[model samples]
Target: MTDLSLIRNFSIIAHIDHGKSTLADRLIQITGGLSERELKEQVLDNMDIERERGITIKAQTVRLDYTAKDGKTYELNLMDTPGHVDFAYEVSRSLAACEGALLVVDAAQGVEAQTLANVYQSIEHDHEIVPVINKIDLPAADPDKVKLEIEEVIGLDASEAVLTSAKSGIGIEDVLEAIVTKIPPPSGSRDKPLKAMLVDSWYDPYLGVVILVRVLDGALKKGDQIRFMQGGTQHLVDRVGCMRPKIEQLSEIGPGEIGFITAQIKEVEQARVGDTITTVKNGATEALPGYREPQPVVFCGLFPVDAADFEKLRESIGKLRLNDASFSYEMETSAALGFGFRCGFLGLLHLEIIQERLTREYDLDLITTAPSVVYRIQLGHTKTEDAQEILLHNPADYPDPSRIESIEEPWIKATIYTPDEYLGSILKLCQDRRGIQTDLTYVGGRAQVSYELPLNEVVFDFYDRLKSISRGYASFDYEQIGLREGDLVKMSILVNGDPVDALSMIVHRSVAEDRGRHMCERLKELIPRHLFKIPIQAAIGGKVIARETISALRKDVTAKCYGGDITRKKKLLEKQKKGKAKMREYGNVSIPQEAFIAALRMGEE
Candidate 1:
């Protein structure tokens, strides 16, 4: 068993594309965790989607044995965490399992918004953060400036910050040495009853459910009967192991160690993240302070294109949920989209990744509805003692405006960092979305601005627009603030006087008319011209705010009456008009799947 003082548990935290994974690869290489032939770029990113997207969606853990210059061999447990704001929950959980974090910053880019957000989280967890200025080999890299920025913005001491080029393996040893010496080792007693924290769990085809755990107060051994403190489900531990990028079986996982355990658990749901694990007999009486449940801020509907594939989609979603606990869904049938699940996500990126996984991993074609944020609807006046408040998930389920005393929409405090050249456009974009400027500061030629914006506005195309306007230089990170009263209304799209529940959305009143007009125009272009004219209208309550008409594909009933008298031709046309009107009343506007997809992808044009 490794001594507690000789073991260090730490995580690598940084902004997206700031070299967290690359640094991990270097560390693994120098420490001999993997042979040169076995080592690949981003070896921890095992998922195909993660590799293809070049982003770490899941936090990966690996154990490495390193011999320090002082001639002492140490055990290092490294948690490589995602940098995207959508995966902040994953980062937090990983941080909870570590005693320190490597705060990576792009040497050229200084510090971005997500860097600040993650640093604050690490500080909140009481992690001893070691600053690392990465990408020093780049021509634009300014390590001195980045160090100063880190000290000023994050208030972390950067005097001893290590400068390294993770891509070229520069300063890899220094980083490792800093981890061994600067980061404190976890404190726990092995004599106590087994008390492990379930850091994460995923389904393995052969192993069933493989749980990654951090032993807090005891040792977990193979064949031991373990009970989940939160779930109260007991299982016999079949295997105890640690990942050296690949699983290596262990006889026992001692206190202050991070490892994996398989207890013959059939489902990943049974092994909840942040649950306390202990021996079934003589288990600890009190459970560890587990993590807070990740709250999904954005929601949308995912329906299969083929109605028959609903069951397949359901199964695929269930399987995906086994790995991602933050994703949530419920069965809901729509008037236009048929049966589907209304799913909640942490953000748009989270929603996109999940949808992409459903399509790529599960081989399912899905149509996603416009993303929306949760809203609080007060059923009666606030003065009433028993005023009912309903949480609105779907716009189609919006309460009657008369009955709603006030509609409060979720708001977010957004931090944006961008070069000075793109500041104007970024500010204009925020203003267009009804965002209130909270603060503005300048850091070494870059503008760091804070805004309070409605989450609904950010849910749809805000990130895309921000990226485009700033030429991908701007980075954004946001946290949900409490809901505030807003003039919000449900905007519904009507095709031939029938409302399409899939296209309905809860929008703020100020821009509803323009938004409705935009939707109507887009739908008019996307929906094919039928035998009868189809009037696409956007309405709020009973009031039609915008309308577009798709003219009928006429057959020219009077084409053969060229030589006939005017009355004959007129009579033929009149007969055709009556038939068209009858068809309009009876014909079902079969909206093609492409139309729904294009209509939901609004603001791109």
Candidate 2:
């Protein structure tokens, strides 16, 4: 049995591009977890998109054997996690499995938005934190200034913080020593009934499904009958193992240890993340706490460019769900885009990742609609308690305004970190989006402001605008603040005279005209000239708010005249003009598929 006192489990947290993955590589090199030939930059970031974007998408866990300065060998598990706000749930699951955290900050950039958000999460989990400032080798690095910011903003003493440059391998040994001395060892009892938390999972053809978990109490072994309390499904363990930089079979993993279990479970949903695992025969008295099913916030419709690829799209998503369980999709049909699925995601980033994966992994051509948020509407008439409330995600299902007593939308609490010079611009942007300032503070030269903003406002090009105003110097993070009453109206677009359901959107009543005008103008640019004039109109409810017209293609009817008299040419031209007018009165305007998408994609990035 492993000594719990000599084992330490911890996670690395930081804002995106703050060198969290790079620091993990340095520590892995220092501990000799993998040989030089097997080691590479961002080793823990296994996804291609993650490596290309220089971000961590999924949390990675690996066990290391480190020899402390006191000549004692210790087991260290590094729970490398995603830093984006879209993956906050992933960060929380990682923190729950660790006894401590190494808060990594960029030496030159100081503390940003995600830095403070993740630190508070670590503190909330009651984990011991050790601040580490990375990228010190940069010419503009100011480690001293960052230490002070960490102390003042995060409320954590950084006098003992380690400063290192993962690029140059400086102070690598110091970081290892800090992990051994500063981070506390794991604490739990091995004698209790089995209680494990499933933190991550993946599917394999040979093994069916495999789950990674942290043993909160007792032990698990091969052939043990296990059951997930949240899923309520039982299975006999097929194999028990550990990731020692590579998979290695083990007889049993005791308390406070991180390991894997493949229990002949075919479905990934049965071994969901944040669920508790226990022995089916001699179960723990109760399940572990803090298990929550992921609730999707952003929604969109995805359809294939070719109708025959519908089955292929379904198969691809099923494979993806084997790895990503947070995203949900159902069969949905559209008049403009054809048959597709209505998919739900945690946020915009999550939706983008899933769509990109389907396109790349499955080699499928997909058409996606504009992303939207789920809405809560209170109907005017109700026969029962359940009948009073209704949830709507698609704009096509919107009811009459008279029937809706009130409409509510989701709101979020956002934390923005930016330089003091751009504070006024950011404040103006937030106020324009209906944000209510809750707290404002300054840490050294940086301004950290907190505001409560509507989810629809933030999800619509807010991040892009924040970067544009700050010139890429600002970082932001947010959490859902629940739904509240909103003055929202469904806006529709028309091509010629026909309404397009795919171009429908929900917008605030105050800015309806402005948003409508922009949509009509943008649609005019994307639509090609037809035989007859095409009118693009944007309407809120039954009232038209904006309009634009695209002129038809003109043809030279008298061009074939061969030395004809001037009277003959004039008569021919006049006759052709009348024909054009008649066609415009009775002919239909054919709009390109791209025009339908362009209207909904108007306004901003």
Candidate 3:
């Protein structure tokens, strides 16, 4: 029998596109957790989008049984976490399942904003850090520089750095050996009361809600009745299982084991991702470890194009909510967009994914308004509530000055890491976006700057501008800081001539003039002229500053179709006329694609 004390539970953490997934594939191969016949890079991130995007969106866990040359079989539970800041909450939950973290840094690129943030998170969790300098086979690989930077910036030992090319499988075996040698084993008594905290979860069609958890104390088994600390729900455990990355059914789960438990649960709301699952009758005297409250940083209006599809969209969102507990939904409507729901999310990416899934998976066409960060306002003699409570999604519902005391909006603790050459450009870009630089430090040849920015400033194109300014060499990451007082106004766009009420945003009044003017110009490029000229305007409270005129269709229908069929030409012109009517006609203009695309791109800028 292998010595169980040698078993190590750990996770790989890094910035997006920094080879975290690639390194994970190599580790799987070396430990024989995956066979040669089943080899595929980044297989742990099985979702189609994950592979296409080359990023891991969710955390996956696997166990590897490796026998060292000393003839010892050690079981290693390896958790692969998402590298993007969008999934920071999920990342934290994944970290709770492991006792150590392998902090992988790009040898050439050095540390990124996400890397620094994740490293800080790991330290907060009190996990032992094992630094791995990855992508060493690249032409720009600089292990010595990265090693020294890690020691100086993060206070880790330079000698402990493991230089590896996970792509070429170099230094992978040593990494495993280092895990056994450096990372400590889980410590807890199996005899304690059964207390385990659930991290990430999924609803399998066959197994119902498969809850992934780390046993903080004692043991749990099949046939046990579990009580969920969340909402005080309870269920009978039908099965307990562990993942070899290929599910292995087990009779029980022991202390420090990351595994799943299945009950007869039909709905996922009962077994939330961060909920505590415990023995009903013989569970812990206190609640399970690592429970966190869900908070939403961004909110958007989602409405189906067809009223008949409303219920379908609602059902689709319900299904998505099963997998993502952080996403919340509330019934909301707007005169411009009609029936819709106000969906809450952790960040911009979360809102986009839900919209994409609603269209792709649910097969429902949607009309989503621009995302808005929830604002806080003091009303009615010092009563504080989210500005969203004022129902500002509709212009008619916006509160008057007398009804509001002070308006507060979300803020972000943002960090941007880039090459030293791009510092000036990046600073100018950040300044334009209203970002306040709180600190700046040098890591190797790269520079890291911390900014306290209003989330509204970045909710649009901060990421895009960061990449554009740095020539795609810079990376940025942010986490929600609290809410702050802000001077913002709801600006509306008059598509063609008529104002479509749904397409408005809460923007800083200072930039409204420039943004409106730029938006109208961009819209002129997207919207095609039909029968009449189209005038696109950006206005705040009925005041228009910038305007664009889309000239009328000069030659929409030729005086003759040449030698072509006249019926086809007539039908096309008739269709064009019908499109003009369907458009929200304001005065004499007809708006088209350019207007919609411009509105969409505004969020990016």
Candidate 4:
């Protein structure tokens, strides 16, 4: 076994597109973990969607062997984490397993919202942070300026920060040297009882459940019986290994070491992330502190385009749940969309990723409803203590406004970083969404602005509009603040006098009319014209707020009456009118799947 002092556990933290994965590639190459032929860009990002989007979805870990200037071989455990706010939970869990973190900042971009957010998390975990200014090869790169921003904004000293171009091979050795000299080795004792932290787990077809763990106290060997402290489930460890970007078998994982173990556990739910694992025979009396459960911020309904695919959709969703514990779903039947599932996600991006995976990976066509945030509804007008409270996920389930004493909607504290030129428009956008500005400051050429906005307003197309207004130069990140009282109402869309449950949404009463009108107008353009005139209306509590009418297709029934008397022509027209009215009364408006998809994708234009 290697000495504890010769091992270092650290994670790379940065904003999206700040080169965390690229830096990981260079480190793995320098350490000889993978040959040049086998090494590629984003080697740690294994999913197809991740490579396509040029983003890391899942946090990946690798063990590298690096020989330092002291002529001593050292084992480095590196956790490469995602940079998006939606995957911040993954970063948190990864940091909990490491004693130090490498903070990467883009030299040209300077400090961003996510950069500040991630640094704060590392600080909370009490990690020793090594600042690295990356992308120094770019023409616009200003390492000195970024160093100052890191110091001013993140409150981390950057005077001794390493400058490197991860894309090229410059300053790679200095980074490795800094990690060895600056970041302290993990502390643990092998003589104590086995106490391992379950960092993550996933499903493997052949191996069943593959669990990633960090040993804190004693060594974990193959063929040992392990017990999970949270679930109280015991299993026999069948294999122990570490990922050197590829699986390498290990006889045992000693104290302060990170590795993976397969215990033939059939389901991933049994192996909870952040749970304590120990020897079943003489397990530790007290359990390690577990992670806080991830709360879903946005929710929407996902329905298969074809009703016959319900079973297939269920199976696909179940398989996905095996890997992602943050995503939650429940079966629900909709009058308009038939059978479907109401799903909850951490954020809008997380919801999008899951929907895309359902379509691309499972080969199923899906229709997603408008995203909504959770709200707390007080049921009665009686005293606050006596009134019952319910959490509302879907607007269709929204209780009557008269019955609800008050509604409390979730709000978020948001931080936005943008170039000075776009600051005015960004502020205006936030204000339009009912935001309350908390603070605003200037960091060099960029403006750092913070606001408290309702989660309902930010959930729908806010990110898209922000990107467009700022010309893609702005970065935004947010965390949920507790619910606040809001004057909100549920607006339902009715086609031919029948309410469409999937199109209903909760909106503030002040903008309900404008929002309702926009929805009606969009539906008018998307829904195909039928033989009978179709009337679409947006209503709240039986009161119509907006209306649109799709005029019926005209077929000339009087054409055959050419050269006839005026009375005959008039008679034929009257008959046609009567038939149309009857059809309108009895006919069911068959809304095509595309119409639902397009209508729900509002404000994209």
Candidate 5:
């Protein structure tokens, strides 16, 4: 029997690019969890996109038996998480599975936007935090200064903050020692009914649905009938296993342990994340209360570049969804782009990664429409009865003008951290985006500013602009602040008098004209010149805001003539002009598919 007293379950939390993944790699090395040949960079991060982007996409759990200087062997479970703010929900789910967290920070950079957000979350979870200042090998490493900053900003005792360089293997042993001493073992009783927290789950072709779980109470064994309390579904446990960086079949696992369970489930929906698991016959009466269905904030259309590939794209998404439950899609059609799926995502990076995976893993080319935030549009009582209100997720679904009484857009409170020098530029950029400054403070020569801005504004180049203004020295984190009334209108782009739904966008009424003008001008450059003039116009509710024209293709009238008199040349020129006029009278302009895509990114710098 394993002693519950000698176990520590904790996760690593840090800002993006703060070396959380590398630190995880170092810990694996010091513990000798895997052989030298078995070791590689970010062993826990399993995705190729994650490796190439140098970010952790999924929260991976690995178990290691670490022998401490106290002459006792301890089981340490490390749940390394994604650093981007988009995965905040995932972060919370991973934290709930642990009793403590290793708060990692960049030695030179000190505290960042996401670092503070995650630290606060850890505090809320009541997880014991062991601060570790990483990247001490860098020339700019300032452990002492960062220690004070951690104390000042986070209110945590930084005097004992571990200083380590993941690259040089410095202070790796100390980090392990701190984890054993500082983080308390989880408190639970194996005598109780089986209760496990299913933090993540995915589909395996052979095994079907495999769930990553954290045991909170009792014991889970193979062949036990289990019930997903929240899902109200039961299954027979097919396999019991743990990831020691590899899936090792285990006979049984007790409290404070992290492992996997193949429950003979065929679909991902059966094993919803954050749901509680218990024995089917004598399960706990109350399910865990933390389960929440992930709500996607950013939405866009994903259409097959080739219309015939729609079914393939749908199947590919279905397979991927079995892995990522947060990613969602529904069948949708566009007047401009044929049948497609309207997909929802956690954020821009999540959206991009899924798109990339679909293209690479499934070998399917896709046409992705411009992303949009959900809007709440209220309509007064109809002619017959009750008031009508609509929640619009796609711009193409905007209702008629007369039905819209008011529009409300989602807003978020964004915290931006940067040096004092770029305050002016940051201020201007926020104001232009219609952001309302809520608070500003200075900490250790760095400026921390908070703004309440529309979610749509942030989705559209806000983060990129913040980095550009601060010269790449800024970090930002935001949380939704609910919806508020806004003067918003749906602006549409017309090519050759035909509306292109993919090019439509919801913009503030004040900047509708400016945005329309920009869109028209951008379309003029992107749309090819046809035999007849093509008119590009932007309008709101039938009111034209801006217009541009792609001039007709012109040919040299005398280029093909070898030798001709002046009269012959004049006659040829007149005949050519008459033919062009005739063509213009009856011909229709054909706008290629790529033009619509180009218009979506034309506003981006």
Candidate 6:
């Protein structure tokens, strides 16, 4: 029998909050990855921010040993995949390391847009699918209905599905048994030159570059020299280990096994997703499949809330990048916000995660600008340039177009999930945002509305606004849809009645009016009180239509120090003077700090 017969590899896949993580926790307990008393909610999601947000942002792999009801020991290589589209590419990479996927669906809510998207990806990967209906213990849960939805809509067999309530431990044993029977064992020849795929990576405070690799054709051990074929970096393996949710030293990992390798390598320049790992002595002929560097679609400028943290933010980002290679940015200086970086991300969630890590994990407060999508501009029939790859991150540095050609921004094939009752509202919302509807389908009293929207349109709180309009009953997912020609303009913000070149945004000309109004109002809320009235204006070229006034303060000053409690008044005046010092001074007014932060908190209305 092949070694595969002794090993089972699979992943747990689901949309956010559909109980994928909760079920993984229960599965780990059942399989002896953790003791019952030691189990915590979402234990597989080790990052603090992941716990706080109650969402899985990273794809993590764990190994477990289970004694079947037959009393035979079996190896389960289980991976927990991210639930959102921002990390969808990572999820696909995680799935590539497995032979089967446990497609977890919520019994009450049924299939969401991301669930469908992931299902399609899993099928495309050619993995065997095992449908697991989760949350059956809830009062509103109807596993039978969900089974029908899977059979009728997803084209899966209803009789083969397993019903489970991860909380109550019901059918958890059956799910494990399914893992042994339904998923195939990984089978690769050890006789071939060493070749493996790097699925994911993270940095340990104690250890260095920890890479998660799927051994495809050779054995790897401590002291072995390896090269990241795609990254062009080579190093001696300092250690070989396997993850039991946390890292554990291992003697070796052979073909058909998944484990961690550390080279103590520095820089994300070395650890790349989908790169091939091969023996340095006897290299493989061809790189393994799925070797491509991740390219970020969205970019924004980041500055520290306190200038003191500027260096700290940079150093923290360097460390964060050690663990997360997906974050891309370059250090730079802002005239108004001081030292900062122009960062890039796969999407909005990626942006939020980086911001959260900087603020929460790194302990640095930050200020970020509106995110911009990569643009494509043609100088002539033969000279074309990628906006993000060539254009300067600072709006003030945007090149003049009379160097003359057409420009295009990235677009996405967006799928919005909403209750049937809110279909009309969603459609109107999309149309108003300049979205082009591609398709509309009804499934089990819900609507799947597909539209083609510019990445810039949905980059900033569009999902949040859509969900709010639908009363939190809507879900959104998108994939890049190439580029299209459209009417877009550069909308600049005038702070204290002067154009702050750094705060300009490139938006579709059709939506400029609403965007202008929204931005002007948001700036007013963000700016601190000043000595004279400050006007926040949205302008295009020489024309300005939307304006908001931060009225001159009437009582912010200490009218009287009063009493020899002069210390209190002194402290107050000292703080106000410091605030005034930071504010941008115009001909007749002083602009406050809130204006810099208000854009981040937009869409609450």
Q: Per-residue alpha-carbon lDDT of model 5 for 198-260, expressed as tens digits?
A: 988877888888899988889989999998888899888989988888789999888878899
**Model 6, C-alpha of 458: deviation from truth (Å):** 0.1
Arrange candidates, best lDDT first.
4, 1, 5, 2, 6, 3
Instruction: Quote model 6's TM-score.
Output: 0.90
Best by lDDT: 4
> Candidate 6: deviation at residue 494, Å?
1.9
Please write out the lDDT profile of model 6 over residues 465-522, one tens digit for every residue. Answer: 8888899889888888788766767788887767775578887887787888998887
Against the correct fold, how does model 1 do in TM-score? 0.96
Worst 10 residues of 1 by lDDT: 380-389
lDDT of candidates 1 onward, in order? 0.91, 0.88, 0.79, 0.92, 0.89, 0.81
Residue 583 local lDDT, model 2: 80
- lDDT of prediction 1: 0.91
Tens digit of per-residue lDDT, candidate 4, span 461-576: 89999999999999999987799999999999999999999999999999899999999999999899999999999999889999999999999998887685899989989999
lDDT of 3 at 236: 85
Candidate 2 ranges beyond 4 A from true positions: 382-387, 556-586, 603-605
What global local distance difference test value does model 4 have?
0.92
> What is candidate 2's CA lDDT for residue 553?
87
RMSD from true fold, candidate 3: 6.2
lDDT of 1 by residue, 90-144 (tens): 7777889999999999999889998889889999989999999999999999999
lDDT of 2 at 48: 86
Backbone atom clashes (below 3 Å) for every candidate? 0, 0, 8, 0, 0, 5
Give residue 272's lDDT in candidate 3 (0 to 100). Answer: 66
Model 2 whole-model lDDT (C-alpha atoms): 0.88
Q: What residue pairs clash in candidate 6, if any at all?
A: 526-594, 526-595, 527-594, 527-595, 528-592
